[model samples]
Target: MKPRSRPTLARRLASGLATLVVLAGVAVANRPMVAVAGEALHTYQINRESYKKRYGHWARLPVPHDFRVNAIHAALLHTGKVLIIAGSGNNRDAFEEKSFRTVLFDPGTEEFTEVPTPTDVFCAGHTFLPNGNLLVAGGTKSYEVLEADVEHAAGVMKIKNESPDHGDRVFDKGTRLRSPAGLIYLTRTRVTVPAARKVTHGAHIMVHAGAAEVWVDAEQKGDGAVVQDPAQYTIDGLTGDDAKNLYGVADKITREKQEYGGDRTSYEFDPVAERYVRTGNMRDHRWYPTLIGLTNGEVLAVSGLDQFGRILPGRNERYLPGERRWVRAPELKRYFPTYPSLHMMADGQVFYSGSNAGYGSDTEGRTPGVWDVERNRFRAVPGLRDPRMTETSSSVLLAPAQDQKVMILGGGEIGESPVSTARTDIVDLDERQPRYRPGPDLPKPARYLSTVLLPDDTVFTTGGSSGYRGGAYRGEPRSDLFNSQIYRPAENAFATAADSTVGRNYHSEAILLPDGRVITLGGDPLYDETGKNAGTFEQRIEVFSPPYLFRGTRPTMAGGPTEISRDETASFATPDAARITSARLIRPSSVTHVTDTDQRSVAVDVVPAAGGVEITVPKRAGLVPSGWYMLFLIDDRGVPSVARWVRVR
Candidate 1:
C-alpha cells in the first residue's frame, strides 16, 4: 500500500451528536437549495438506537487473511443482496492489518461473506454494468498478485512475471496510489430450474452511463492475447510512475522533465460477447477524466487537468459510438480540476458538476459553474441543476409532503476542493419566489460523497474524501477507523452511522441492499504520496442496516414498546416518531408461495396516543404473509423512513 500524508493534527474529534444532525440537517446544502426539480417522496432519517448498539451489539465481518483494508467498493444485487469487492490494500505498519481482499454481505442476515479479489491489478471508478456485474478499469500497470509463497499479510502484491505477457495483468511499477491501473466488470445473476439463469434485476446500476467510450486500459499487456501489438494502435499520454513516482517527473529524468503516456492501453469490453475488444480513440488527452452517459445513449467525456498537472482550460467533448465523431459541449466553465461529478436525473437531464479547478480569481475560470445540454449539441435534456459556487445564488430543493415534490436537499458554497462549506439555497424550478432553506452543517468536510434515493424521499450519502486541500500538495487525510454515516430526509441532516467502523477513503463505493441495508466495499488504497493520508482505506466489506433488518441488536431498555403494523406495506418516519428503536413488520408465515413488495414508507401518523401505539396489520389473503412476519426496523436514525425487504420461502 502507498503511504498518505498524516494529519499534522486531528480536527476536533468529530462531534457525535453533531455528526448525526449535520448529516441530516445541514444549515445549507450544495445549491439551488429549494428547486422545483421533480416529484417529492416522504423522507426518513437513518437514526435509530438498536443500530447504535448497546452490548457487543455491532457484528463485524471477518476479513480474509492478510488483507489490510485499503478501500471497499459495494454494489446492490437485484436479489436483495449487497456484494462487496475490496480494493488493493497496503501493509503500513506491523500493527496495521494488510488489506486488498473482497467480501459479500447479506444485510438481512447481518452476515458478511467473503469473495474473490482479482489478483491481477488495482482499480476503481470502473463502470457498474446494467447487469449485476461490476466493471473495473485502470490503476497501476505493475499490478501483480503476490507469489503464493509470500505471507498473506505481506504488503507486496509483486507477482512473479512468469507468464510475462500472457495471462493476468500487471500494475505499472512504482505507481502512486491515485494513479489509474486495471479496469474490469463483474455481474450477478440467478436462474430458475427451467430457465437459463435469468438476471432478475439489480440495485447497483447508474455510474456515468453504462460504460461509455469504453475507456480502455491503456496499460493492459498483450500477454500473447494480442491480435494486434497495440490492440487499438492507440496510446494515451499518462504513463504511471517511473519506479514509484506517478503523476510527476521520474528519478531518472533527462532534461525538459519526463512525460507519461506512449504505453498502449484499452478500455473496451463487449457486453454480449463478454470479451474485450479495442475500439475508438478519445477526442483528446485526458487523465482521470469524468465519463457520463446521456439519455440519448451518447457518452460525455468531461475535461481533465493536463500533464504539467495544471488545470486545463474548460474542455469537454461528446462521443457517440454510432457517430464515431466528437462534438464539443459548451467549453466547460473551467478545467474539471479533479474528481468532477456527472449526475443523471430520472427525467433525462444530464447534470454536469465541474469539480474544483485550481484557484482562478478571473471570472472566466474561477468559481465553478454549470452547463445545460445545449439542445442539438447531442440530445434533448429534461432539465439540469447547476452546482452553486455562491451561497445565495444556488437554488435549493425542499422536503415535499407527497412523493411528487422534487426538492433540493443539498447545495452551497462547497467547492470541489477539500475545504468546502455546506450552505443551502432551495430552488423550485416551478416556483417564482423560491427561498433557500438553511439546514445544519457537516460534522466534518465531505467531498466526492455518493447520493442515493430513499423510499421516504430523503437521500442516503456516505464515504467521500474528507479535509480541505489548501493548494497543490497540501490537504488533510482520512485516518483511524471511521464508519460512514447516513443522511436523513425528514431533518435534512447527516449523522454518525454504524457500519462505517472500517476505514475507507477515495473511490470507495456504497450500494443500497434490497432490504434497505448498505453494502460498502473497495477502498484499500494508499495516497499519491508515500504518506498514509490519500486514497480509500480498508479492504473489509461491511453491511449497514437499521436494527430490525439485522436480528438481535436492540436496547433492552424496559421502556415498554412501540410497534408499527402493516401486513403488505408498512411505513414510518425517523428522527420523528420516538427515534426508531426497532421497526419490524410481519405478514402470514404460513404461506410459502406468497410474495409481496415489503416497501416501507414512513410518514408521521398521529394515532390515538397510546403510550406506545400498536398499529394494526393489513393482509392480502394467501398472496401476502399468511401468519406474522417481522418487517425491518431502523435505529441510529438508521433509516429516515420504513425500508421493506422481501420474504419468499
Candidate 2:
C-alpha cells in the first residue's frame, strides 16, 4: 500500500468545520435552557424571571411583628412552627439592657409569640435533639469594650498606705508616673498628666506636697505605683477596659470595646410550651461554636471564642439528650475552625469540609478530613486547590443522603477580605481513595450563600453577597445579590431560578418547609443603599414555591406511623399509590450560619402495596439518623405532598 497521501487543504478545512459543527451541537444540547418570565435564555446569562414555568416564585409573608426581629438564627420545629432567635439583635442598646429576645412563629396561623431567653444566646450554636427539642449552647456574657474616656477606665490602683476611700494625697517634687499602654491623668483636672513630672506635691523640694491623679487604660490588669510623695507617698485611681471590668463600681457605664466574652449558659426550647427552659451549661464558654448531631443521637459542640474572645482550641464537648447536660469530650484532641462545616458519613464518621464562618488561623484546626469519633483520629483528605478560601463558604451533602458525596460552593478569603471565589469542588466519601474533584463554578463569587436541598433532589441556592459579609462592593445597591440558582446533580449543571424581592447577606438563613417551599429570612447588609452606616436588616420573610408546586396536583399523604423502626417496611396512605414514584425522609432544620449538618434528605425505597405504599427505612443510623424527619410522598411528576412528621429510631 502506498504511504498515506496528504489530504487537500480544502478537504482539511471541511473536516475541521464539520468537527466544530458537531461540537457546537453537543454544547447546545447539554446547556440548560432557562425560561425567565416567558423568555428563554442560555445558562450563561443572568435571567430575571420572577415567574417561570420551571423555576420558583417568591411570596412575601405577613409577619405578626411586621418585621422579623433581626432573626440571626432560625429552626423548624416538629409542630410546624419556626423558632426565631434574635438575642439582642446585635444591637448595643438591646445587649446592654439584657434584652435577649426569641419568638415562635406559626406558619399556619401567621402569628408570632414572644419567647423569653434566660440568658443572652446571641451568636450561639444550636442543634435539634432526637426528642425534637432544640439544644442551644453558648452566648454573650457582656459586651466588652476599650476606650480612653474616664467612664471606661481600665483598672484601679490603690495608693499604698493611703485611705482607700479618701483622695487628695500629697506627693513630692520631681515625681513621675508612667503607663505602658495608657496615659496618666488627674481625676480632678480631667487632663492627662505629662509623662515627665515638672511639679510635685509641695511647692519646693524641701517639703513640697501635691495631689496626683493616674488614669490607666481599659483592660489593664496591672497596678500603678507611686514614684514620688516622699512623705507617705501613695497614688490610687480606678481603671478598667469595659463595663464588665467595673467590679466594685455601683454606677452603670458603657465602654467602647471590640470584643465580648462568651457565656456558658445553655437552654432547651420546648415547642409544646413555646418557651425556652434553662438547661445544663457547657464546661467552657463558647461563642460562634458549631453544633452537629452525631449518629448516636448526641450533639457535638466544637470551635468557638472563649469567655475572653480568644479561640478555644481543643475545647470539645458533647450534649446528652437524656441528661440535658454538656460533658467534656477530652478524647477529641483535634480542634476545628470556628463554625466548621461538618457532615456525618455513612460509616458514622464526621467529615469537616474546611468551610468555616470566620475566626481561627490556618495552623489551628483548618484541615479538612473525616474524623473518627470513637478513635478521635482524623483522616485528612487533600485536593482542595484553595483550602484557605473556605471561610464563609457553603458545603452540602448532595441529594439522596446515601450518595456520600459533598459539594462545597463559593467562599471568600480567610479574614474580612472583599475577595471571593466562584469555584466549586466535590468529594465522594464512598470512593476507596476519596479526593476532591472540580465541579461547576458558581455564576458569581458569593459569600454567606444559603444552600437548600429541595424535595425533588435538586439543590437550591439563594441570597449571598459578592463582598465580605455582604458589604464593600463597587456597584450600586452595595454587595447583596438577589439572584438564585438551582443545582441539578444528575446533569452536574446549574440553572438560573427566580430572583428574590429583597437582598440577603450575612446573618441570613433559608430552610425548607413541610409544604415543599423555602422560607428565606434575616439579612444584615451592614450598610444602606447609600453606602452609609445603617444596620440594614432584611426582616421581611420571603417564601419560594419550587417549580414542582406548579406541576399539576400534588399527591395526598395520610396515616403514617409517628415513629419508624430501621430495616422495617412502614405503611402510609396515599391518594395515588400508582402515581407515587418516590418517598423521602427529610430531617427538620436547625440552621444557622449556613452550616446545618443535621439537615439531610434520605430517599427511602418505596413499593406499591394493597392500601398505600411500603417504604423501607435504612437500618444504619448514619443513613437515617435517630431523630424526627419529615416523610414526603412524591408523585411521578416530582411533586411532593405535604410532609407528615415521623420519628426515626
Candidate 3:
C-alpha cells in the first residue's frame, strides 16, 4: 500500500492562519468565501480565502531535498514541452552558478529531467524567435566568494544542506558537479533576435498578425549575403506573403562599465534579393519589453524595466507599427509593480496584471487589474481572492470554459517593498467581469515562481527560494527546494510534476515542445546534482525530457520547412517521419471558430488517396473564438499542411 505523508510546515501554517480569521463584528456578506470544488487547483501564491482572510502560506511538497528545488521561472515551447527554469540547485563546477539552476518537465509522462544550463547565463527574459525557434537572452552568473563576474554560460547550481560559504559545514565552497569548483551566481541575461527581426522599434504586448521577419546573432550566416553586424537588430518585410516570413524582434542589454555598443533598434541584412526587406519603424523606444504578435500583423510592446533599470512610470506606452504610432497609456500606478504579464484572450481582449515586488506588505500596494482592449482602457480587477497579490505574479491563459477563462497564477511570491507573501490564487474570467476563485495551493515556492501553458491544456509550475522553515532570503538555492509540480485546475488535482525534469530559476526560460515535451534553455548555470563545485565557472546547454513519451510528427525532418536557407542554425524541435517529410503540400481551407472547443475542421486532398480520415488539430484545437477559424490542411497519412489565419466571410 502506498504510504500517506503528513501535512508540511507551510501547509499547516496556511491552514492555521486561515482558521483564526473571523468575520469580525461584520457579517460575512461583504467578503464572501471563494467557493471551489474538490478538483479545483489552488495556486501557490493565491488560493480560496486568499482574499477573505489573506490566507494560504508556503505549502510545498513534503518531499525531501533529494534534488527538490526552490522556485523558478517557466516557459512553454511550440513543441508542447514545459521548461522549468530553476534557480539554485545541487550542481557544481561551472563559472555561472546562480543562473545555472534548471529542470525540464514533460507533461506527457509527468517526469522531471535535470539538464544544466551554460555559464553566467540566466534566462530572466526571452521570446519565440522567427523560424519557430526561441531566442534566449540577458542574464549573468558569478562565483560564491562574491568574486568577479563573467560573460560565459554558467553551469547548474549546487545546493547544500548547510553550505560552508553560506556559513555551514553541510556545504562548503570549491564545490562542483562531477569536478570540484565553487558555487555560481547569476543575473539577468542580455541578448537579441527573432523579436528584433519583427520590429525595427520596440512594440509591446501586441501580436503582428501577418508580418514575416528573421533574426541573426553573432554566428556564421547561411542564407543572407548581407552581414548583419552583431549590435541589436531586426529585419522586417520578408518576400512573398507577409505571414510566410518569420520576424524576430530585437532586445538590448546595458551594464555599467561595459560597452556592448548597440542601438536601441537595428536590422539584419539577408541581401539575397529574395530575402526580407526592411520597412517602417516602431514609433517609440522599448527595451526588453514584452512583444506579442497580433493576428493583424502588428506587435505590441508591453511594460518593462527601462534601459536605466527603472520600472513603469507615471504613464505606460504602447507602440502600433502598422499605424506607426506611440500612444500614452494610463499612468502606471502601483504600490510596487514588476512587469505585468500579457495574454490575448479568445475574445480578442489583451489581459494583463500588475505584480507585487515580493517585499512582504499587505494593503497599501497590490495588483493592477485587467485591461479591456476593445475599450482600450484599464478596468479595476475586482474579487481578487488574495488582496496581497499584485498583478506581478506569472498568470497564464488556461483552456477556456463556458466563455470564461481560468487565469492560473503559478509559483511566485507576493507582498509590497519589504516582506514577501507565500500564497496562491486563481481568477475565473468567465463573466463579463473578472471573478476571483480558489484552487489547490502550491507545494513549493517560498521565494517566488513561474507557470507555463501546456500543449495538452494543463498548467505546470516550478522552483523558488525561501521556504516555511526559512533559511536565506535572496541568493539562496536549496536541495530541499528541488521539485516541479503540476496543478490541473480543471481537474482540481495536484501531482508531483516532473514535467521538464529539472529545477530552474533566476532568468530561466521554458518553451513548449511540439511533441508534448518541454525544452528549457540557458539561465543562471548551476553545478552537479550531488552538490559539487567548479571554480570561477560557467556552463553548456542541456536538454530535458520525461520517460514514456512519443516524438509525434517531429518538425525537424519536415523537409527543413520549405522556408529560407539563412536559418542553417534553425532546426525543427519535432521528430520527423520520412513519409510526412516528403509528403505533398496542400492549400489552406478557409475556416473559423464558433467557440473555444467546438470543431471547425478544414480539409486537404491528398494525391492518389481515397477514404478520408480525421486528425484533430492538437495545437489549433480550442484556440478559436466566434467569427474566428483555426483553419489548416493536412495531406494523406496525417501530415499537417502549413497553417495560416483567415477571416470567414
Candidate 4:
C-alpha cells in the first residue's frame, strides 16, 4: 500500500519549487533594511563599471625606506610632489632622539626623498601661499610630563653618613620655612619629598634655603638632623623612584625650554628647493593653529596652544606674504578651534563650518558662523546638528566656488571618543540668511575623512575611521574605513567607489596628483598586525585612479598659457576642443587633519576656438584665490586630461 503510486516527474518538480519559494520568502522577511527618520532609505544602484569608472582603482606603492615618520601632515606642492611632515613621529622615544622628519614623495616617479625638518613640526597648521610656497606654522615643542618640580627651604638636620665625594643626609620634615618656601613645602608635602639638598653639613646656609621635592623612599633617607647651615649639604646622590622622577622631570623641562620651542618658529617651505626657510614668527606661540588663505591672498593664522599649553589668546595674526611676517590682527578679535575648517566667501568674509581637528572648546571658538575679518564680528549660522561631533570632521567648498556653498561631513566627539557620525550638511553663503540644510548622508559614520574636489565638479572623499582619530582608542584596531565615495552635487547623491587596500586613519593624508590620481598615505591605527607599536607608523602609499581614467583616451593639452588674468579668455590647444565640455581650475591642496580650505575647484565657461578652447577665469578673488592651479580639459564624456600648471593672477 505504501508503494502504491510513485509521483510523476512534474509532481516532484512542483514540490521542489514550493520548498524553494518558501525559503526565499523567509529570507526576504528576515533581511534588514536601513532607515532614516523612520523612512526606509534607498540604496542607490552601484554600477560596477560606473563605480570603477568614477571611483577609479587603487594600487599600493612600496615605501622607499622603513621610514618611521608617520605622516601626521601632508601637502601637495606646486612642484608635483607631496610633502609629508611627520615631526617627532608621535613616539616619545623618537622625539627624544630628534627623529623629527619630513619627506618629499614624487607621485610620478613613485619615489620618496627625505627632507630635513628644522624643528618638531608635528601637529602644525599649513596652507599654500600665492607664490606656491607652503607656509607651515605651529608644532609640538615638548610634551608635558606627569611629574613637576618645586623649590623649598628645609633644614638639613645632619649628615648621617659620608662616602668620598658622595654622602647621605637627613632633613627635618617639620622645619618651618618663609613665605615662598612655605608655599612650596605645603604644595608638595604629601605628594613628594626632598630628593636633593643644595647644601651639606659643612656648608653655610641662610635661615632658609631652596629644596626640590621628588618621589623617594622616606624610610631609607630618614628625617632631618640639626646643622648650622642647611645650604652646606650638597645633594650628591639619589636612588629608587627619586632618581627616575628627577631624570624624567629634567628631561622634559630641558626639551620644553630648549629644543621644542618651535611653536613661535614659522617657516616657508620652498617646493622648488625642498627646504624650509625661516619666516617671521607669529605674535603668539601656536601649537595646533589653523592657517587659512583669505580671499585677499593673506593667510589668517588662528587658534592653537600657546607655549605654556593654553589655548592661544583670542588675538589672532595675519601673515603678509609680501612682508613674510605675521602681524597681530587685533581688529579681527576672534578665536577659533584648532584646525578650524574655514572657507572664503564671495564677500571676502570667511566662514567657520564648526569642523575642527580636535581641540578648543565651545566657548573658545568652536561656534559655527561667518566671520567678517574687516569688522571683527561673527554672525552665527544656525542649523548644524550635533555640534559636539565636529571634531576630526571635514568640510569642502562645493565645486564652482562661485556658488558660495560649503559642506561639512563626518566627525566625532573629541579626545578618543568612540562615537562618530555620518551627518552631512551644506549652507549657501550667498543667501540673505545662510543656514545649513541636510545633505546626503555618508554610507557609514567616520572621522579623519579627506575630501578632494575633482575636475568633473564632484567631491571625492576617502580614508577615515569609525572611532576616534585613527581609531587609536577603545581597542579599535580594525576601525579604519577603506570604502570611498564620490558626492555628485548635480544630483545631491553619494556614489560608492572602490575600496582602498590600506587603512589610513590618524596621521594619514590624501592629495590629488597632477595626473588626476589621488595619492593616499600614512596612518596610525594604534597598532599593526605584528603586535608591535611599530605598525602604528603607517608608511605605505596608495594611489587611486578614478573612473574617468578608464574611459577612452584622455584629452591632451597641446599648449596653454602658464599664467592667466582674471575675467579674461585663456586659450589652450586641444585636439578635442570641439568635444571639450568643461574647463576647471583646481587649487593644489596643502591639506592636513581634514582642514583643507584652500583647495577649491572653479568652473569656467568654455568655447571652441580655432585649434583649442577659450576659457574665462573668474574675476572674483573669493571665487578663485590667486594661486597656482591644476587646469584640466574635460571631454564631453567627462574624461579629464593631465593637468597643466597655471598661475591665476
RMSD of each: 19.5, 14.8, 21.6, 13.4
- For each candidate in the order shown, give its overall lDDT on alpha carbons: 0.34, 0.76, 0.34, 0.74
Off by over 4 Å in 2: 1-51, 144-257, 474-477
Q: In lDDT terms, which candidate is top?
A: 2
lDDT of 4 by residue, 1-649 (tens): 5767867757755765565556556556664321221121111212234446665777777786655358888888888888889888677787788888898888788778988889888888899888899999888866644222212222212222222223322333332222211121211122223233345456763222223332211121212221122232222244554333222111111111111232688899999999999998888878778888887789998888776565766768899999899998888877777778888887788999999866556556777899988888899999988778898889999988888889999899866688888999999999889999999999988898889888888888999888764544345455778899999999999988888878787777788888988888778776565334545567778888888888988999978888888898888998888789998999988777777878888988899999999999988887888889999999989889899999888
Candidate 2 vs candidate 4: which has greater lDDT? 2
The order of the candidates by TM-score, greatest first, is: 2, 4, 1, 3
- Candidate 3 lDDT tens digits, 1-649: 9999978768966765564443221225543342321112233223333321221122222223333343234443333334444433223342233445545445456465555454222212333322222223222222222113322322212121211112222212322121112212222232211221223346553333232211122221222222222221212223443223222222322111221111123121111221222323322233334444333333344433332233434234443444434455444322223334555554555555444333223343244455555465566666655455442345555633323354534323342222233455566655666766666666644333545444233455554333211223354433224456666655776656443323443334343333323343322323333334522111222333322122233222222223312112222222322233222111111100000111113221212112222222212211332122222232223334333222221
* Error in Å for residue 541 of model 3: 4.9
User: Candidate 2, residues 517-573: lDDT per residue as tens digits?
Assistant: 998998887678766677567789998888788777899988779998889888998
The parts of candidate 3 lying over 4 Å away from their true place are 1-263, 266-288, 317-336, 355-368, 389-392, 400-403, 410-422, 446-450, 467-480, 499-502, 525-649
Across 1-649, the per-residue lDDT of candidate 1 in tens digits comes to 8998653223222334345355444325633422211111111122333334421123355664553344433444434444443434333231123334554445566555555443311322233222222333322222223334222111211111112113332233333221122221111111111111223348553222111011112122322211221111111233433222111111111112111111112233332333334434444544344454454545566544332223346666665445444566654333443334443432344333233322222233223223345442322122223344421111111122212122222222444433433432222323333223344554544433434434334444444444322112233343222434445656656656543555444445554444444445544334533345454344566656543344443322122223322242223322234544434332211000000011122222232223332233433221222211223344444442333332322
In model 2, state the lDDT of residue 107: 79
Segments of candidate 1 deviating more than 4 angstroms: 1-58, 66-285, 305-335, 353-370, 376-437, 447-452, 462-485, 494-499, 522-537, 547-649
Candidate 4 — worst ten consecutive residues by lDDT sum? 248-257
lDDT of 2: 0.76
